[model samples]
Target: MSLVSALAIYFIIWWMVLFAILPIGVVTQEEAGEVTPGTESSAPGRPQLLKKALLTTLVAGVLFAGIYWLRVHSGLTLDDLPFKPPSAR
Candidate 1:
């Protein structure tokens, strides 16, 4: 893949991993018993976004490395899939 394609794939994977990690270890204001006035009790008390972002980057990097290896070194392609297009059949 070209540099632009690699970067784009990494960006998409990073966002997906970030969303998947976002809800982990969440602590709502209601659960912590410190709901601020006029704020929703369901709001996260300590989002720890920086930590999650770092973790997401690490996970995404590992996953992207695997994908890159498969694409560049595994010698596999869409044609290797077991299923075939109806038209092709």
Candidate 2:
């Protein structure tokens, strides 16, 4: 894949992985018994966003590498999809 296409795919994978990792090891204010007066009880007491972001990057990199390897080494491509383009008819 071209650099731009690869970067775009990686960006998408990183965001998806970030969302997936966001809830891991979370501690809500309610769960920690430290809900502030003005904030929702469900709000995270310690978001640890930096740590989660780092983990997300690592996971996304590995996943992207696997997908890239599959695309290059296994000859997988959009043509393998079940549907066909109108022009192919």
Candidate 3:
């Protein structure tokens, strides 16, 4: 692929990462647990939920960076079909 196409792909992924970290609207406690509002069960669950979300984001960033590095430097991925055909083997 051309340099422009490769850079565009990277830029698109960066935007996706940014959106994953931020959102448009707020989800109330009740909405998160799928229960009615003003309920006791949803109140204490937010901390745990936030913790999980942050951890997921951190892991995703690291994983994406690693994959990007591999693509930019090493010749791997679907774009590089290194496998030989059966006849060649």
Query: Top model by lDDT, which number?
Result: 1
| RMSD to truth, every model | 2.0, 3.0, 7.9
* Residue-wise C-alpha lDDT for candidate 3, range 43-86, written one tens digit per residue: 44344446556655675667666777787678677857676666
Candidate 2's C-alpha lDDT?
A: 0.96
TM-score of each: 0.93, 0.84, 0.38
User: Which residue runs of candidate 2 sit more than 4 Å off their true CA positions?
Assistant: 81-89
Measured by TM-score, the strongest candidate is: 1
lDDT of candidate model 1 versus the reference: 0.97
Candidate ranking (TM-score, best to worst):
1, 2, 3
> How close to the true structure is residue 17 of candidate 3, measured as C-alpha lDDT?
64
62 Cα displacement, candidate 1 (Å) = 0.3
Cα error, residue 24 of model 1, in Å, equals 0.2
Candidate 3 residue spans exceeding 4 A from truth = 1-47, 82-89
Over 1-89, each residue of candidate 1 has an lDDT whose tens digit, in order, gives 99999999999999999999999999999999999999999999999999999999999999999999998999889888798557843
